[model samples]
Target chain A: LAKTTQPISMDSYEGQEVNITCSHNNIATNDYITWYQQFPSQGPRFIIQGYKTKVTNEVASLFIPADRKSSTLSLPRVSLSDTAVYYCLVGETSSGGSYIPTFGRGTSLIVHP
Target chain B: DTAVSQTPKYLVTQMGNDKSIKCEQNLGHDTMYWYKQDSKKFLKIMFSYNNKELIINETVPNRFSPKSPDKAHLNLHINSLELGDSAVYFCASSPPTSGNTIYFGEGSWLTVV
Candidate 1:
């Protein structure tokens, strides 16, 4: 399992775009980078993921460079409701043999209005 | 419909007691996981089960046991719970073949006094 490092917290005003980055120096060849968002008193929700280059979804975008040692999660047009903790994970497997792996402390994004 | 759901959103119990948190997923996925979030907000993987078989078992205490009776349900039973067990427990599910996206249940806040 690769260990990930990210900011503990960040703050931004509503309607602004926020970019949070994660560092995984020991990422494995089969490791994929994923991001998750969590609100207070709630579980972490899936955001976006990528192996290399970039991947985007309705919620967020994930960017992984060639080295795959780092990734960035971009939340466009933030809102106060977007204030939550964001986690960046690098793993070889998830639930089952699918996309499950290990997750680390995510960045806390405080979207202000 | 809720993709993933957990029971007893909040649990307050005394130490040395036994308690359980139930999780279910309606996404028809084959894998489920249990995670613990400490007060400082660090999320760690405790266990992962796929098709009722244990896959990844972190170095968690033996007091924490995860049982998956079927494909969609994964229940966590903590025996002789301790004060250190007080934290937010999250249940997540994902298709065994999914590339990145994983669904998460709301969470169960367990407070041991």
Candidate 2:
């Protein structure tokens, strides 16, 4: 399992882009970086996953450098509803094809008006 | 219809009480997990079951037992709950593909009095 480090919190205004970076220095060759979003009383929702380079979804975009040591999650045009905690996870598949993604102390993003 | 649903969205109990949280995923996924989010908002994986078999069991207490009767269900039973057990419990399931998207249930808020 790879341990990830991220900012504790971030502040942004509505309509602005928010980017959260995660550092996983000891990432394995087969490990993948994934980002999740959690609201106040809901479960964490999957945002994006990537190995290297960049991957974009309808919700967010994940950018991973070639070194694979760090990745960034970009949320475009943030709104008040985007205020939530973002988790950085590095997952490794076990022999039985099980993926137990471990989450760190997520970066709480507060989107203001 | 939600893909993953858990019963008792809110649970309030006294100390030393035992409670169970049932989770069902209709996403046709074979892997399920139980994660605990503390008050400080740190998500930790407690148990994981794949194809109705226990695969990942973290260093959680024995009082926390995860039962997977089938591929679509995973229930968590906590015995002799304490004040420290007051947190949010999330049930998540993933598809057979490793390191892919994972769906989480609307957490069960457990408040121990």
Candidate closest to the true structure, highest TM-score: 2
Q: Candidate 1's residue-wise lDDT over A8-104, tens digit each?
A: 8999999999999999988878767778888887878777878899999898888888888888898899988899999887775533454446677
What's the residue-level lDDT of B71 in candidate 2? Answer: 96
True-contact fraction per candidate equals 0.57, 0.77
lDDT (0 to 1) per candidate: 0.85, 0.90
For B1-113, candidate 2 gives per-residue lDDT tens digits of 99999999999999999999999999999899999999889998998988998998887999999999899999999999999999999999997555778899999999999
Supply DockQ values for each candidate. Answer: 0.57, 0.71
Residue A33, candidate 2: C-alpha displacement in angstroms = 1.3
Candidate 1 chain A, poorest ten consecutive residues by summed lDDT:
A92-101
Chain B TM-score against the true chain B, candidate 1: 0.96
Model 2, A25-84: lDDT tens digits are 878888788899988888998889888999999999999999999999999999999999
- TM-score of predicted structure 2: 0.94
